[model samples]
Target chain A: MRKAIAASAAVIMLSIGAIAGAAEVKMVGTVQKIEMQGGAATVTLKDTKSGNEVKVTVKDDLTLDKFKDKRIVDGDEVRVKYDDGDGVVTIFRKTAGC
Target chain B: MTKILFTGLVAGAVMASAAFAKDHPGREYMEKNGYKGPETCEVCHPGKAKEFLSTVHWTHASKVDNVENTDPAREYGMKNRIYTMCNGNDIVNNLKEIPKTPDAKGTKFSGCNTCHPGNHLSDVGSAGPEAEAAIDCLVCHSREYDHSKRKPFKDDQGRVVLGQDRSVKAALAIAKPTVKNCMTCHEAAGGGVLVKRGFAFTKENDVHAAKGMVCVDCHKAKNHKIPTGFDPNNWAHDGVRVACADCHTETPHKDAEYNRHTARIACQTCHVTRTGGSFAKDFTTWEKLSNGYYEPTTLRKDANETVPVYAWYDKTVANRPDFIGPKGSRSDKASRIYPFKVFQGKGFFDRKTGELLAMDFAPPMSNGDTLAGVASAAKILGIKQYDPVPGWQTVLFGSNHLVTKKNALTCNNCHAPNGVLRFKDLGYSDDEVKRLTSPELYLQKMAEKQREEW
Candidate 1:
């Protein structure tokens, strides 16, 4: 019973660390296009929240499998999650190829 | 009728005068007709000719005629053909063979014209060394034409045209010998050039042999002049040292230091002795047992025991007892004294009464005449011969000991980029320059990668 309680506490700490490390970036716009090359994926995301458009690149390993095949184009509503690290990564509903 | 006949007579006289003008030898004939005879190009260029001749360019040229004294041909499929140059006074002593007719093909002699044309032999009224040299450049380097031996092809007119041997003709047409002149003959003629194969003329095949390197970079004549020399200490040869390590270093034995001692020993020293420019040797076969194969020979504890056995062998065998093979089934106890395994030292073989040999060495067990001992080692290990690998050697010699019988230079001694061939006379390419630069690094990298898997 004591070990189980300790394990739950460790999980709670890891979740809090992940949330602290992440920052919420809000951009609502139409999807432009998605593309993949050299193990990196680029998603053209237009801001529906800010009326801005930007293309973000993400490591191929970080993206979900369902998003892999989704076709993205201009003027389509979409949601995205991303990290700004060495380069930058933006996860989208669809990529440039889709 | 009388007037017409007079007019014809006048016309005929004018035609006769024109023919006379055309037939007569004039100032042009005097300028180009003949040689001043055998004058050394070195008088002006100093070391250029000697350096150039040492290159694969001059030494490895195909269609080299006027080499009257080569040894009897031994190569397979070339029966009665002349290969090596004959020794001694074959020309003076064998006078009966004099006034000899050439083989089926007309004789082709070596000269400046063999690679460089025009003033190389001289063309009528061709003036200035620059003019002569310029024409030579046009023939060889221009992609608009190819001087390589022609294969059959169709002309723009859709007529079949056979390519002639362009080596001689192209040089002749150019009217001068240029640095690029030698490439037509040097780059792609199989073993004729360097006694080495796998030379491709295009940039994709060999980026360097194509660029700047030419024949004179390595070879030298009676006098050494071309490459002033490179610096291991002083930093010469345009900043590159002209030595074997300049291009290659993978030695079969462990370590460069060990190889330095073993590599200098000629193939014939261990594997054979000179037998009229060839070795009188044999490769013996051994009997197969359940586990391995065995050959008949005495086992010697050391070099002292080997001497007596060799003495007896010299007296009994028709040929000298220089070559050894892994043979088996001895009738005499003395014959069985030195088994083949003893010669290879330890850990080179399996412990058995009889076993087939195999070879596991680089440069492969080819060149039967040169590396017979290495081949014997491979055969004993039951190793089948594989595609031969290319190799380079470094030769450090004692003052008295030179590399080759013809000249003191060894194979790698003069064949690399920084040798005498680097002088202006013999042109080598840039890619060869890069390849010849760091053979040691290449060996190191190969060993490192191999260790990863091992």
Candidate 2:
């Protein structure tokens, strides 16, 4: 009984760590390019704050609804959210008025 | 003893009369000149004066809660306070609570009596019924108020001294307001005729004016709350109270396809092809003078013939952002394709920060300047050093005038190969244009196959 309780506590701690490790990363940047291929899009973004360029991959099925009837394009100032663990972009939105 | 008493009474009477004249100088002057003041007009049009006070023309700037406050100049702490050229001396003095610091001399214009007839002289406070009599009712009501005679003289403090000859003429000629009366100040706004916006009110090239529809017809003011059609987020909030659908309903076009296009295309996209012609120049370059005024160096090479740039706009947003680089896709529901008069100019941007500077630097004291009037703006904005960016900034304003339906673009104008509409830039796939343009070929092939089967 003592051994089972210790094992359960260990599993819970591991789950918490896994969840924390996969925290979402948000960045504001201008899109430099979007290369679409095989139901996925690879977007190159130039960070507005840091001025550094980063390439992010977005899967086709990963609900890009924030772009809502619009596709990601070059020269678009967008705010993007991505899962840091997998390094995959999940959401994109225009950051002009907002 | 009788002579002394009589002399004392005469002196006292003179002193009392002098005090009365000093207190009500504006009223005394109007009474002597045989001019009935605003008080007389107010007795008949009582609600007008109260209603006019609520309008942007009377107030100049929108209230703090209004969308105008969301401008980058205000949001980024560049413009500390909303200072308008329309406020009188009394209003300016009352606005001391709003924090503002101007570095340059003679930058701020004192009083708005030059344009606003209802406002009294800067010295004579518009207070009681006697003071309220100073409102010039004929400025808006009369077509005979000659603008050339309305010469404004300012004291050393820049306050407008009223009692000009035009004031009396304005009072006498109380007729209904006409298009000419409205154009006196509006046409000359931003230094010269049609200098502010390329499509601003000019006698020629204005589709509405050519159609015999005056400014008041579309921009009907009720209690002076003139609707400006500025609210982007809500069509209901568009101050102009009128919409294109009001005149041209949902089924304006006879063709089903053309009528269907209305769901995705703005009316001005087809109606207003180009602007800046006739009385106005196509392009104007403002050069700042040593006297701190901007003079336009106009380029009229393509006057009235320049093609308007196209963009997508979401009407629901107040203060729409410029040029989102065409619709991302044809399915973009938030935005409709719209036409714009593109104004290309060199504007200052911070080289270090890469942020566009939001300082007013231009002609027309009311409309804040951005780039050309930077020297004067630097003082007002409290910026010490100035470094201009290398490239030019292209600003786009919606062109809804100069409407010539005959000059409207057809489908081939945009869909053809090497057309003005950049399909790739509009976020269409590579083959989208080829597929859209050559539907006839596919139909021909299908017909040939059907004939072969027969």
Candidate 3:
């Protein structure tokens, strides 16, 4: 019984570590397209540094007020933070304004 | 204890030296490189420095009397108020109050350092006496100055760093101001190449440049006062001398009719045909960054050869206060036919007030605020009700450069009834258009010629 309890605690700690490690990944790129559907938005970015395309889906809970007076437009330089696990954008920031 | 005190004293001395050294790196670099700074030039060229200081380049703003000479400030009013990006601080004014700190939004004004070497906008912390001393004498005199590594000094917050570290080595490269150097700022004026004056000035396109004649050959300057005959207020000034007739004779063309047209038509009307290239147009919109500096985004360009728009310019000013006749009509004594580049674009303005809102289209919006939309732009301009004025106005830019002598317009180009020259729009009477374009009129002239032959 004691061994089983210790094994269960170890598993819980490992699961927590894995959850912490799955943090969001930030990237700098140019916005290729922005598709808004209902309460969600999917943005396609062409990475300026790597020249690779990245697609990030933004849910209703995503924060985007950082752009201040500017709106998200195609071809704008943007810095995006996304969940590494689901590739969902959590923060959409316009980098060109800076 | 003794060793610690000695170390502390040494460190303090080093820190003090570093602070003092940062103030004048250009001078130190010149001393080390065996090249003399502006101080050395001033010793020998004091007269030239004094004369240059009086010129418009150093003053940044030209003094013009107001149409109504009632205000004292009118004496120092700018000739081209649209290009007044830099506040009056850049002008060598004794009475003007200099700002204690650089503008928060990193707004750069066209000042003395814009054309003068060794002077820098980022290093404006050393403005008064120190900046005057650091003038790079070799920028216009030496043939080796390289400003390739120069970059805008910005802080970690992305705001332009005031009194930040500059690359001393980058500023030391000396060179005589060539056509390339002059174009460095001029080409970028009004936001980049081919945007301002509509002259696509390239080595291959410019007729005089192709002939190996430098800008100074025609724009002769004495005491640093360059001749610009376009300004009506300054036209009578003794410094205004160079004109088309100065170089090209009155009868430049072999045809007598063409020679007769010179009195009413500007030289550019026949010389400049079209301008613009693939990399010529910059339609990029600048967005404010978090740090208060604006960066270009939504970069777009259109490469197309645009024909020059002909106008009636009285040779006094490129853009006069009153409206002239239509495109082809030359009626007024103060007006003659001239070619111009008509720049069309959309902008925002106050609908209620009918005033054009000067948005922070160019970076460093007057206030250190970010203009993200109509609301933000209105707030910056202090407008209550504003709307986007799409395709509102067409700006007229004088097309004087890019002369293609081979592609000169023929008589039919203008004389034909439906020719490029819109005679009707130019306020010409219907009778005049009929007489100018009528085939029967040509037949009558031919019949008269035949009778003379008989």
Q: Global lDDT of each model?
A: 0.29, 0.48, 0.49
- Candidate that scores best on TM-score: 3
Whichever of 1 and 2 has more lDDT, that candidate is: 2
Q: Candidate 1 lDDT, tens digit per residue, B96-139?
A: 10111222112112111223222222221234443233233333
| Model 3 DockQ class | incorrect
lDDT of 2 by residue, B1-454 (tens): 5436544544554454334323222334544656555555565568565555544454344423333325533221101221111001222222111112242213333222235544335222234443345455556665345433343445577544443323554554454455555654454332333433445443356655554456665566666666554322111222446656655676677566678878877887777777552222211234332223333333321225577766666543232222111222356776777776655433345576543443332232223343444444455557677674533444454566666656676565655675566666555787886765554534554476579989
Sorted into a CAPRI-style docking class, model 1 comes out as incorrect
Query: Which runs in model 2 stand beyond 4 Å of their true positions?
Result: A1-98, B1-37, B63-137, B156-158, B161-176, B200-204, B230-240, B277-303, B316-330, B350-378, B381-391, B418-420, B438-454
When summed lDDT is taken over every stretch of 10 residues in candidate 3 chain B, the lowest stretch is: B91-100
Evaluate candidate 2 and give its CAPRI docking class based on DockQ.
Answer: incorrect
The ten-residue window of minimal lDDT in model 2 chain B covers B78-87
Error of 2 at B340 (Å): 0.4
Give each model's clash number.
Answer: 74, 15, 14
Chain A TM-score (model 1): 0.47
Task: Name the runs in model 1 displaced over 4 angstroms.
Answer: A1-98, B1-114, B119-135, B140-182, B188-198, B201-243, B246-451
Q: Model 3, B63: alpha-carbon shift in Å?
A: 2.8
Ranking by lDDT: 3, 2, 1
